[model samples]
Target chain A: MEDTAVLSEIESGQERIDLIRKDFPILDQSVRGHTLAYLDNAATTQKPRVVIEAIKRYYEKDNSNVHRGIHELSNRATAAYENARVRAASFINAGSSKEIIFTRGTTEGINLVASSWGRKNLKSGDVILLSEMEHHSNMVPWQLLAEATGADICYIPVTGREGLLDLSGLDDLLSERVRILSLIHISNSLGTINPVTEICRKAKEKGIVTLVDAAQTVGHQPLDVQEIQCDFLAFSGHKMCGPTGIGVLYGREQLLEAMPPYQGGGEMISNVEYHQSRWNEIPHKFEAGTPNMAGAVGLYTAMDYLDKLGRDWIDEADRELADYAVNRLKELPELEILGPPTGRAGIVSFLIKNVHAHDIVTLTDRCGIALRGGHHCNQPLMRKLGVESTARASFSFYNTTQEIDRLVEALKEIQKFFNQ
Target chain B: MFDDIDDLYQQVILDHNKSPRNFRVIEDADYVAKGHNPLCGDEVEVYLKMDGDRIEDLSFQGSGCAISKASASLMTTLVKGKSVEEAKQLFAEFREMATTGNIPDGGLGKLEALAGVYQFPARVKCAVLAWHAMAERLNGSEESISTES
Candidate 1:
């Protein structure tokens, strides 16, 4: 079916949410003898039929090592794998397919930039600045790299309770000595959306490199790298309704060409001498061995699925869900919602009075609601908020107000249970 | 299905968490040790005031899940008057019970409230964090320990 037709069908019906919900088979089940209300999209999204079928079809039909296969299967595998690069490139509006490289996930993508670009550019007196709200995946690599290079790691303070960056010291922070400004496009723990385009523009004026961790934003929003114009953006496919163990690092062609190859192995080399080996081109140089080809195919289908639903449409739905969730949660006076009160993305982190996050998650799981409770790989942000942890419920377009209602009800019972 | 959860969050656990016993600093503590559960971001400090081989007073200070807080509370209540060697024996038995489901012959008395903890593997560490800190001070090892270890 055409994108517009399927989208119109979804929009046309009075109660066609079941149509979209039915696309996800796993969500139809029960957990712990209760109906499933999965709210852990930030951790990993539930895969759609299209993504699952795409992955299965690839494995059943085109199972071969890419780039070096001798038969038809190998050629088909290589073509499908490389074609995914183009789709992904178009997905993010990257400059070219040459600028996109495949990696294990957001973790490896950041490590690549830290190990490759960081090693080449950072010096003793230079600084690597990160936002206070960044996930550990984005912060840890820079910390290790800064230590290795004797460069300093400083934070752009969170301005207020909203968790926005403290832009008052922008000029002081992004100085001549600052080499990189790596920040989150959207915080997973607190759902504050950072103005990366504006931040990137400032960093550009200072001639500083900027890397955006878009792990939380890509699936729910319509992204355009040309608009942000950051030097690099890293995101994971698993968080975006695709398969796990696959991610993308989008670097400018010139920057990728300048950095050293992150890992040296087979698909990343041009020639192997007895003592000297020449590296491959921009992406291949960065992607070392045979890549996760089926993962690429699945991610391509996942993006196609999102595009068909329409990124703008999904974003609007997610925003509505978040708005509804906040409004519903306000009924519980004991609960305090974190992040902005309104005009945020798909996540809501909250805490109930005198209730530990782990206990909330445990009780909610009994009702078949999956919530993330802990520092959420954002210990620094948790400390900044003066909280040990908060329970987060993240949504994709497939989620509905009904699930949020269940969550609120479950939380009320949980609070009552603890008070007992 | 959540009968286990109800068991896990018993009235005793709730009461102990609401108003923990011996939850303070032993000002003249002879041994002090800290324990952290990195996964849950919980911190605990176990202080012991000993008179030769007997424990004169004991207390704990920190914040965590209800299970950890309650475990610390009950632990302090049970170990305050016991001798140092007796506390060590109880720690060994409780550790065995919590981890391996090998209940000691003595049934652990009030500490049996934690038997529900074995059903939830992820929470087993929370029930043992205070014990780890107390053991650290008693055995004279590292100043700070993480349950992750």
Candidate 2:
């Protein structure tokens, strides 16, 4: 009860609201001459001024290759880059900074694990357990890995109830040959937040290693690796107000040590001779030549911004805003909201009866309400939902109740316009 | 709030979208072809009854947005009673209009309204879904007909 009151206070506070808005300058602008109500936050969140400035500062002051040159600029760049590793470790509550390796983004992180760890660990006849709600990034890599390794891939079926993964179906799907369980922590299409902590606990009991794709959930909710105890976790920087082309892969120290390096390049090698070469330890071993130094600085600054905003407060605001939007949208008879009606992240996926999602998105774009349309990189989930595509309105901490009302207004116009 | 779009969302397009033509399957179809847009999951299957060179009957059944459905509706009106060669020519003209944003050679009467679609490159598939299905029927198979549009 006390927690609820504090959350309400945080939501209603004007200072806190203004502070959050002030951080993101792009939110102040308009689209198509109308005030932009950006509801496509799930695809990628708008970066704050602090994050953008950090990248600028790095490029202006410390522009050099990291960990190589004896010059002052190189030392400054290396220190800043390594500092980001420590920040990422603390962000997810990982055991050590060495467990955090930077990659291009979430897609690259998943591919790295699938190519390196999957190749070394999985064998022919082994099974990999996946859920039906996985993004194409999470699904395709595993499919390719299974084909290459001659391993069998199985899915945990989702009951038609808001497309939630059926926990009851897990026992039937799991087998003695099942070596790994990879699932999305929060579904991008359905907005269903899976019970990953419980899922991770169960997988551990069966001696199956787990990989949690937190691409959608990391910024929306507070995540603790110690609490979840998942062996590996991956998320992108762009989706969390950070720069593009930078992401983090958090692996258990022991698991990372057991896996071989993904790519062979200059920075990843410790020593080289004519006959043989020695690889650098864990984090550096995974990161190849000439990393995104400016991106790393921006990501570190984005993390600092998120931390200052308070995760609990942001989550509360997003939930309230989503609930309000969903309820208002439900009032329109033509719109059908997808996924579990009550439990979800900040996203709301829906389709207007007899209206194409693309058409709805196009019309909505003309209204300056930026929403995502189509399968949202989860074709399988779209198939299961019996929809070719849906218009998704995803929110973030910066979104307001008034913006949701604007979406509702535009939606009403769509129903009337299409029905006419 | 959506005042800017009020002009673009014309009444005719909305009316066609609401009550689309050729929306039902024909009882006896001489040839049938399905058109699919993989990006957005829009699908249309056209059924045609050809009487030698001229079309005796035409219909379509599928789901998609206003542009695609309206295009399908207009296609039924355009191709009904036209010769097979004339239908193919119309397909080429429509393809030119949709892709290049301008009708080549001469004017396209009712189909000229679709010129608004040229502004949206992603929506070009929606405008041509039905025409492609009809072209498949004329060609005697479900193979895709790329219009470069």
Candidate 3:
């Protein structure tokens, strides 16, 4: 555990990856008589053993309803849960744990914000600015909010297949009538890394509230709420080597305090009467029911494991795999890549002429290479790119260049099978 | 690879997908219906010209995956000159084959190429998308059908 030993271990990347690979038990298996090469990280990540153990340890030892009973088990459960909140707050460099609210994942976090803050602030004439490449989770909540509040929803257009934002008219779009600017930090399908810090700064200067959907960026890269300076940020735990049914929503303290509670129930109330109830503080007010305590514990361990692996290293490793996959896929003449040629993240979306994405996915699955196909919940973006669907290969830090090679070979065999 | 995937993407299916029959719009079609699978973004438009109780001509045009496209192409040829009642029976049989993996009494002929779709629960909808549209049209319903619904 010496600093020099750790430095040397990280210096040898392959050895470190081998060690990391052993931490995920699911990866050591075979699928369809071939070694599994999982390239579907964009959908969800395989959990590490430590995270799994953390959840088990919580349920076995400290299982109790948090902030309730006067017993020791309840005290232990409350401590673990609050400690997870502290970890989440620190993981994103938020001002305090009070600003971190746990929810069912990124989808629920967005809905909570839309229902609570959006309903309270938006007026009929106001505009909610979004981007064209947003996932359905980020778009649908705002659409519902707009419908209820009579607000107009506008989009920052995407520029063709590259999936970069067309910000030429951003100033005009950020007019006085615009109330909020919500966008993704990194596109899940296209691997486009949006300049969220700069975008948040621009929105801040225009006095518009900003929310960054960090669902795809948080685990792969270093995230600091102070650096991004956004009013709100949302991310899922399952996408980051943690358990499902838990996520963090980091909001500015003032904004969270001013917003009304998203739901009404037991734990979120300070004083309850037959007809009226006083709400609790910032985060507790939004958490209306019994929270996912085990999920929170698993997320805390996952975050710790990720920090140990180092964000800078994970980011570099992911980008390297994506670039390698993109280069190898380019060898096929009919393949057309979607996303930036350079500076793309770990995701690579592509289409082959005369070969459907579903076919590619099904064929590649035969070779034990998993890939995502279809709109990836960005149907509007898919239509904008003039494709019904695209095959996507997303990577994580545990993925190696050899896995990318297997993917390339599988894709070649699929092309040949289709006589392309 | 071919051996492993042949059952799902049979040679007949690939042939139809590559060069789909009746892949054009019929301007004077008596019935037209669009089929969509919003989950995967697969869409197909079925065009039919019926002579009383029998289908006089059938065609289709759309963009979708190979399974959906091939299924649509085969559907156009299978039910082209068949009577409305016979086509409905075939539709029911096709649905049965796709969901239960049980071929009809004498087998489904060219449509049997899609019988393997029963192995893939996620792709059964792809195999039946065009059939659903055609059935809706034959039943005199002009509404667009979605496999998701």
Identify the candidate with maximal TM-score: 3
Q: Distance from true position, residue A278, model 1, in Å?
A: 0.5
Docking class of 1: medium
Give the TM-score comparing model 1 with the true structure, all chains together: 0.97
lDDT of 1 by residue, B92-124 (tens): 889887877778876898888887788889889
For candidate 1, list the clashing residue pairs, or say none. Answer: none
Worst 10 residues of 2 chain B by lDDT: B1-10
Pairs of colliding residues, candidate 3: none
**Best of the candidates, DockQ:** 3
Q: Please list the C-alpha lDDT of all candidates, in the order they appear.
A: 0.89, 0.84, 0.91
Model 1's alpha-carbon lDDT is: 0.89
Per-residue lDDT for A119-227 in model 1, tens only?
9999999999898998999999998998899999988999656777788998899988999999999889878888999999999988999999999998999999989
TM-score of chain A of each: 0.98, 0.96, 0.98
Recovered fraction of real interface contacts per model? 0.61, 0.71, 0.71
Give the residue spans of candidate 2 off by over 4 A.
Answer: A1-12, A273-276, B1-8, B26-31, B48-57, B81-85, B133-149
How many residue pairs clash in all the candidates, one count each?
0, 0, 0
Ranking by lDDT: 3, 1, 2
Report the lDDT of model 1 for residue A287: 89
DockQ score of the complex predicted as candidate 1: 0.62
Superior by lDDT: candidate 2 or candidate 3: 3
- Candidate 1 Cα outliers beyond 4 Å, as residue runs: A1-5, A12-14, B1-4
Model 2 clash pairs are: none
